[model samples]
Structures are given as C-alpha cells and as structure tokens.
Target chain A: MAKGGKTLGEEALQQVARRFAVLGEPMRLRILQSLMDGELPVNSLVEATGGTQTNVSRHLQTLAAAGLVARRREGAQVFYSVADPSIFELCELVCGGIRKSLAAQAGSLR
Target chain B: MAKGGKTLGEEALQQVARRFAVLGEPMRLRILQSLMDGELPVNSLVEATGGTQTNVSRHLQTLAAAGLVARRREGAQVFYSVADPSIFELCELVCGGIRKSLAAQAGSLR
Candidate 1:
C-alpha cells in the first residue's frame, strides 16, 4: 500500500517495472486483446493474433507467469483469460495518452 | 480512432508496446515519479533517482521519444516533466493489479 507522501520502495518499483515489461510486446498485447471478451483456447488465440501456435503459447506462458492471464485445463485443451481486468484500464490510459500527444503535436504545427 | 466493435490494428498495438517498453525500467519510473509534482532539471532528477546523470538523461530521452515526458531547455539546465498525465493512471492500474494478484496468491496458500 502507498503511504501518504511517502515514496515507493525499491521492491514495489521493481514489481511495477516487471508488469510493464510483460506488456511491452506487441504480440502479447494482441493476444490479450483477443482474450478481452472471454477465455480462448490456444488455437483460437493463434487465429486471433495471426501468430503461430508456438509463439502464442510462449507469450501466453509469459502473461500467465506475470499473473496477467489465467490458464485453465479442460481435457486436452487449455484456455486462457485475463486474470486482471486492470490491464484494459492500463491499455486505455496509454492509448488515450498517445492520442492526446498526437493532437498536441498537430496543434503546435498549426 | 477506435471503431465500434473493431479490434486494434498492428500499428496501434506496436505504438502501445513502445509506450510500455519505455516505462518498463524502474529507473525511468523513478524519474517520472520525481517529476510528477513538477518539472526538474537533469541534476535534480539524478539526485532524486539516485542514478547517474548520464543514465537518467538516457532514460529521459527514451521517455521523451515515446511521448511520455517532455523536456525544456532553461539556459544550461534541461528540465523534464510528465507530458502525459495518463502515465500515472497506467502505473496505478498496473500496481493495483499486482496487489490483487499477490493477495489472491496469498489467499490460495492459506
């Protein structure tokens, strides 16, 4: 928990960094977007992301390791879904910021 | 602009990943935190982050490239500030998600 007027300790900062690193790959973001609506099997993720099954699985493993997504085993197929909804908020914040920055740059050009 | 019921295109996803990669470093996060209140010169950022001036300046460059922060020249001194306030929101979202994940893991252990 953040204390009032207190700086974040080193450990907390590192944890935040790790989370950002997990989201730093474009393919991973695409996979996450595919899973936004509901859990999806590996093949579905591959189709949605237009990535190979190996590549999608690798990214899914990383996302799961970071606790961004949850994996469930049902018979032979494994489905992945977002374990944390906050990811959408993070993406929206970043995307919105990019839009604002672009608009500012355009304004300055005029 | 995101269309209704449309998925993000590759270019947009790449831009988002670039933004996340810029923020994936703890040192960069620390610099951003220091500048949260207001703009600060390079030396001030170095002191606040306990990082070398060169390293801090390098990270600042990356951040500025990503449009997350902006730099201004004040005579011989250069100051940096969060150009996009959305950064704080993104950090808060990721940090909150991490906290929730940790709590869930702890609960499962009990």
Candidate 2:
C-alpha cells in the first residue's frame, strides 16, 4: 500500500498507536492466534491458549474493544472470530520482517 | 498469510509483541511515516515531525533497536529509512482497521 501521501494528524496517529498497543500483548496475540481458525467460544480459547479463563476473557475484551475480533452469543456460550481479515495480513507482514531481521543477524554472526 | 497452523512458543510470542510495542508509539510512527518516501537525515526528520533533534534522535534510536528502521552513515551525516517495506503494509492494515471502526461508530450514532 502507498503510505506517504499525507502526514497523519496527532489524533489519527494516536488511533493508530492504540491499535498497535492492542496487539502488543503476548497473551492477546496468543488469543488472536487461536481465533484464526474460525469462531471459537471462551472455553475453547482457554484450552487453545492454556490460559486461565479470566485471563483469556480479559484479553478478549481488549481485543473486542480494539475491533480486532468480533464476538457473538449463542445460548449461554460466546464465540469470537477475527473481526477483519486484514489483521492476519498485518501479522504476516510484521512476522515476515522479523524473520528477515533474524536471518540477517544470523548471517552476520557467521 | 495463514496464522493458525501452530501455536507460537512463548519466546516467539514475546518477539512478536515486542514488534507491536515498537510500533505503538505515535512519535515513532510519525518518524516512520516520514521515512516512507526515502531516506533522510536527522535534521529533515526533525523538521518533518516538528520535534526537537534530541527527541527525534531518541525515538529513532528506539526504532532502529527494534529493527523497524535502518541507519546508514555517509561522510558526517547519518540517514535513516524504513528497514522493511512490510512496515508500510503493517501501518496500512492497522490504519484501515481503525478507519473502519471509526466509521462503524459514526454509523451507530446516526
């Protein structure tokens, strides 16, 4: 994507930063990773992440607030799925860069 | 990119979170946005960001440490550029999500 046409205003920058902060927690990322398969309920997420239900729920709340995941209710159970597919694209881009940096560092060490 | 094949280990999760944290700061994002066009020296970044040289330099150091931006020294001047083209992709993805969320919120208010 072309990214340099205009400078971001302070408010816009903060909104962007807020999105990054939402994705900055390891536990949150774990929860997000689990949801990538499809919609999953809280219990399944807890099992998938091996995290306490309370902890997983807390992260889910944050992720929902950030619009990274969408939640649905069926009977007494709640299911969550990725709110936007672009999230995975973002993850892939960052992870690809990280892999490249690691490869370069290893090359330098040799 | 697919993101759910295997759960990331703790170390890998931290590495990913660290990348998010690096991008979580508004000032650093501003600095990065400035460099999307081409490499620039510290002084130009200071002007583009309306930030002091010391402040801009400090954020640049943090960005470099995180592998988000790269530095090159020529003669007496140091220039900085986005280390990976994927950085812009990440930004675009997050920004697009934020815009969508905002639009949804606005729609609800109507």
Candidate 3:
C-alpha cells in the first residue's frame, strides 16, 4: 500500500499503533496465545497465564476491545477465547517475516 | 505450542511486550510500512512520513533493537527499511484476525 502522495499521515499510523499498544502487554500476548487453542473460561485463562485475576481480566478486556479476543458467558463462568485464528496467521507471518529479514541481514554480513 | 504447564511465564510475556511496545509507536508503524516497499533511504523515509529526522532516527533504533527493521549506509546517507515482508504478514494477519473476531462477536450479538 504505497502512499505515493503520503496519504497515511501520523494520524492514520496512530490508529494502528493503538491496536499495537494494546497487544504490547506480554500478558495480552499470552492471553491471545491461549485463545489460539479454543475458547477458554476466565478462571482457566488466569490459571494458564499464572497471572492475577485482576490482571487477566484487564488484558482480556483490552483484547476484546481491539477485536483480538472475545468473551462468552458459559453458565457461571465467563470464557475468554481468541477472536479467531486469523490472528494466529498474523503472529506467525509477522514472526516469520522478521526472522527471514534477520537471516537475510546475517547473510549479507558473511 | 501448548504451554501445558505455563512455560511462558510473565518474563517471556515482557520480552514480547517490549517488541510490541516498539511497534506501538505511530511513526514506527509508518516507517515499517514504508519498508514494506522494498527498502528506502532515511531521507526518503522521513519525507514519506512527514516526520522529523530525530523521530525517524529514534524509531529506527527501537525497531532495529527489536529486530523488526534494518539499515545500510549508502555512501554518506543511511538507508533504513523494514526487517522483512513477513512482518507485513503479521500486520495483515493481526488486523484480519481481529476484524474476523469482531465480526464473529457481532454475529453472536444478533
């Protein structure tokens, strides 16, 4: 998406950055990763991350707002699961992309 | 990659968070986005995003430290570019994943 005329100014970039900032928290990453498995309850999520209930709940709410994860009321418990696997693809691709770039840089150094 | 026993503790999450934090900046996103267009010089990058030299330089360091971007000196001026396209995949995937997740939630609400 080349902005031949520089269409994507700081404002547009900031919008995307907000989403990235929400994902900046490690607990959020772990939370998102957990959702990768399937929908899981809040208690189970807390146990999975070994994080405080308050912390886990906070991160879940952020991810939910970003559309990265979702929550569902399963009877007495509230299950927090990933919004979808497409996010996984993004994680894998981004990681893969950076790894590949690093390898290429290393190659030039040789 | 199941963390059957919470292999990814809070520490691991912090490491990932730092990386995310670097990407969290708007100027950095624009920088990374421009790098997506193969590779470009620092001046071109600055012009593309309409940001200051100092801001661009600072962001480049953060991105480089995170292994998300790289640089090469072309004679006197330095050319900075994204570490790789895979990072693009991550961006696309993350955005797409979240969009999909949100859509699903909206559906459930209906």
Query: Largest lDDT belongs to which candidate?
Result: 1
Backbone clashes, each candidate: 0, 0, 1
How much of the true contact map at the interface does candidate 1 reproduce, as a fraction?
A: 0.85
Candidate 2: stretches off by over 4 Å: A1-6, B1-7, B106-110
DockQ ranking of the models: 1, 2, 3
**RMSD (Å) per prediction:** 1.5, 3.2, 4.2
Worst 10 residues of 2 chain A by lDDT: A1-10
What's the CA error at residue A73 for candidate 3, in Å?
1.5
Residue range B24-91, candidate 3, lDDT tens digits: 78878888888776788888889987899898888888888777877788898988766655665555
lDDT of 1 at A92: 79
Against the true structure, candidate 1 reaches a TM-score of 0.95
- The candidate scoring highest on TM-score is 1
* Interface root-mean-square deviation, each candidate: 0.8, 1.1, 3.0
A1-110, model 3: which lDDT tens digit per residue? 44553334455466557777887877788878777668999888899888999999988888887777767897899987765656555455544454565567789789
lDDT of 2 at A9: 70
Mark the regions of model 1 whose C-alpha exceeds 4 Å error after superposition: none
Ranking by lDDT: 1, 2, 3
DockQ of each: 0.86, 0.72, 0.52
CAPRI grade of model 2: medium
Task: List the candidates ranked by TM-score, beginning with the highest.
Answer: 1, 2, 3
lDDT of 2 by residue, A1-110 (tens): 34353667778889889899889988889989888789999999999999999999999999988888888999999999998777777777777899888876688689
